[model samples]
Target: MAMHPLSDTDIGDIHSQLRELRTEHHDLDLVIAHLIDNPPPDELLIRRLKKRKLLLKDRIFLLEQMLVPDIPA
Candidate 1:
């Protein structure tokens, strides 16, 4: 969905959300690594975690784009 031009407050809120998503994404990275490092890892749980991480990554990218104004060439 295309968001309308955001007010400063809205942008701030978005920025906060971006930080939270990034933190979660980083935590997921650690969790995923631990899951892989342990023997007899639960493949199903790892797969789910990986999928969640991907989704969070996508959201982070989108929010970053929204926060940064694109420069025209």
Candidate 2:
């Protein structure tokens, strides 16, 4: 199956989503760090947060790739 190219609006929307995901990923990092600093942190919560952060990282990478044009050699 062939994929359609993104329009200007679609690209803009993707950029916006990328920014939000990056911000959330950074925020999660801070929260995880803080939680670790406190004694006897909730292991379950930390694990969940780590999982979410990983997912966001993946999404961010995908969006970034979409922004780049493919060149034929």
Show the lowest summed lDDT stretch of 10 residues, model 2: 1-10
TM-scores of the models, in the order given: 0.86, 0.91
Worst 10 residues of 1 by lDDT: 64-73
RMSD of each: 2.3, 1.5
Native RMSD of candidate 2 (Å): 1.5
Best by lDDT: 2
Kindly list the per-residue Cα lDDT of model 2 for residues 1-73, writing each as its tens digit. Answer: 2357889999999999999999999999999999999979989999999999999999999999888776655
lDDT of 1 by residue, 3-70 (tens): 56778998999999998999999999999999899978999999999999999999999888888765
Stretches off by above 4 angstroms in model 1 are 1-3, 70-73
